[model samples]
Structures are given as C-alpha cells and as structure tokens.
Target: PQHAGISLLRVLLGFAVGAGAGLALGAAMGLSRRVDDHVRPLFTAIAQVPALAWIPLAMLLLGIGETLKIVVIAKAAFVPVAMNTSAGIANVPRALVEVGETFRFSPLQMLRHVVLPGAVPPIFTGLRYGLTHAWIALVSVELLASSEGLGYLLVWGRQMFWLDTVLVAMIVIGIIGFASDKLLAAVEARLQRWRTDGV
Candidate 1:
C-alpha cells in the first residue's frame, strides 16, 4: 500500500506537469503558424529520442533523486500531450472561429468558447497517452535509480529474488494506469456529451 501510494503520487505529479506544459505549448503552436514552424521540428526531434535515452543525462544533471525521476516522467508525458494538443487545436473548424470573430469575441474569449471546446477531444486523447507513457518511464527510472516507489520495490524484490513483490508491483502499476486512463476517458466522454447536448 505504501509503495502503491508513492507510485500514485508520482503518476499524478507527472500528469500535472506534463498536461500543463503540453497545453501551453500546444496552444502556442495552434494559435500561430510561425511559432509552429519554428518549434515543431525541434519538438519532434527531441520527442523522437526514447525516454530511456534521457535517464543517463537526467542522472548526471539531477543526481538520481526524485527530481530526476519526475523529470523523466514529465518529459515522457509532455511530448504526446503537446503533439496531440497542437493537432487538435489546429483542426478546429475555421467556420467556428469565423463565427466567434463575427460575434466580436476577443482572441482569449474565442479560444475559451470555440477553439478549446473543439480541441478538447483530441487534447484529452493526448493526455491519456501521455499519462500511460509517463507511468512506463517512471517505473523504468525507479527500477534503475531512486530508493522508493513501486518500481524501486520491484528492483529490491529482484535483488532479493522475491518474485512475489515484483509481481505485485507490476500488477499495481497496471491497475493504476488503467484506472487513470478510465478516469480521463470518463471526463472526455462527459465533455463530448456536454458539447453534443449543447449544454
């Protein structure tokens, strides 16, 4: 239970960082073609590097501490979210945007009322993908470094030849990831329903 709690916290923290950064970057890219052209290539290149590739560098810079672990998870989380968000926002119907403009909506108001709602389904999809990937990265990081969390527990179990502990940790990670995805999916469904119902 203790390890489960720690793992859950790490997952949630990673989600928050990933989702926030992704949303900001996504919005920037979506709102400006110039910004997208300037940043998307770099973002794509960096994201192409596997999350595991960052472990060595994170350890060197952050010293295998909680910071390193979380940073890895966040990075893993951020890429998908940002990419998806950008795609979602950019795909928002031009007609809706024009209607917003016709109504004299400011840019921010237009985003809030038109663009965001239109983009939400894809945004949520990205967030779900991010959360799943982040969990995998976090577990790998914890198994290799750090001294707490379910991943660490699994590592410790391996050293002690305790397959049961390792099995338990793996199960817990899967369960948590599934639950998180379901929760997000429910939220997405609700939003879709609200949009469709014109509520």
Candidate 2:
C-alpha cells in the first residue's frame, strides 16, 4: 500500500509536468504554422527515441533518484499529449472558428468558447495516452533502480526467486493501470456529453 502510494504520487507529479509542457508546445504548434514547421519534425524525431532509451543517460545526468524517475516519466507522458493536442486543435471545426470570427471574439474568447470545446475530446485522448505512458515509464525506471514502488517490488521478488511475489506485483500493476484508464475514460465520456450539450 505504501509503495503503491509512492508510485501513484510519482505518476501524478510526472504527468502534471509533462501535460503542462505538452499543452504549451501543442498550443503553439496547433495555433501557428511557423511554430509547427519549426518544431514538429524535431519533436517527432525526439519522441521516436523512446523513454527507455533515456534511462542510462538520465541516470548519468540526474542519478537514480526521484528527479530521474520523474523526468523519465514526464518524457514518456509528454509526447502523446503534445501530438494529440496539436492534432486536436488543428482539427477544430472551421465552422466554429468562423462563428468566433463572425462574433468578433477576441483571441482568448475564441479559445475559451470555440477552440477548446472542439478540442476537448482529443485533448482528453492525449491525457489518457500520456498517463499510460507515464505509468509504464515509471515502472521501468523503478525496476531499473529504486528500493520502493510496485516496480521495485517486482524486481526484488525476481531477485529473490519469489515467483508468487513477482506475479502478485505484476497483477497489481495491471489492475491499477486498467482502473486508472477506466476512470479517465469515464471522465472523458462525461466531458464529451457536456460538449455535445453545449454545442
């Protein structure tokens, strides 16, 4: 239970950091052709590297600590969020944008009333994918280095040749990840309902 809490905390912290950065980057790319042209290719290349590839480098730079775990997880989370967010915003209906323009809405007003609503579904999709990635990365990091968390539990069990313990940790991890995804899906569904109603 204690280890589970620790892992959850790490996941949340990392997800927040990644999501914030992703939203900013995604907004820039989605809103500005110039930014997209400059950054999209670079981001795509970097994202293709995979979070696990950063482990050794992160360990060397940040050491095997909370910061390292958080950074790795954040890297894992941000890519999907950024990509989805950019797509979402870019795909926001032209009709809605036209309406905003017809009303002479300010930029912030257009974003709040037009762009964001249309983009909510995809944004939520991004968040869901981001969280899944974050959790996976966190476990991989914990398995490689750390003395606590479910991933560490799995590693410890294997090292001690405790098959049952390892299996239990694996099951628990799957269950937790599934439950988290389901919860987010539920939230997304609710938001979609609201968006439809508002429209």
Q: What is the lDDT of residue 172 in candidate 1?
A: 88
lDDT of 2 by residue, 4-112 (tens): 8899999999999998899999988998999999999999999999999999999999999999999999999999999999999999999999999999999999998
Candidate 1, superposed: residue stretches over 4 Å from native: none
Q: Single out the weakest 10-residue window by summed lDDT for candidate 2.
A: 189-198
- Local distance difference test, each candidate: 0.90, 0.93
lDDT of 1 by residue, 50-156 (tens): 88899998889989777887788899999999999999999999998999999999988998989998998889989999999999998898889978899999889
Model 1 clashing residue pairs (backbone): none
| Residue-level error in angstroms, candidate 2, position 155 | 0.8
Q: Give the winner by lDDT.
A: 2
- In candidate 2, position 111 carries an lDDT of 93
Evaluated at residue 93, the lDDT of candidate 1 is 92
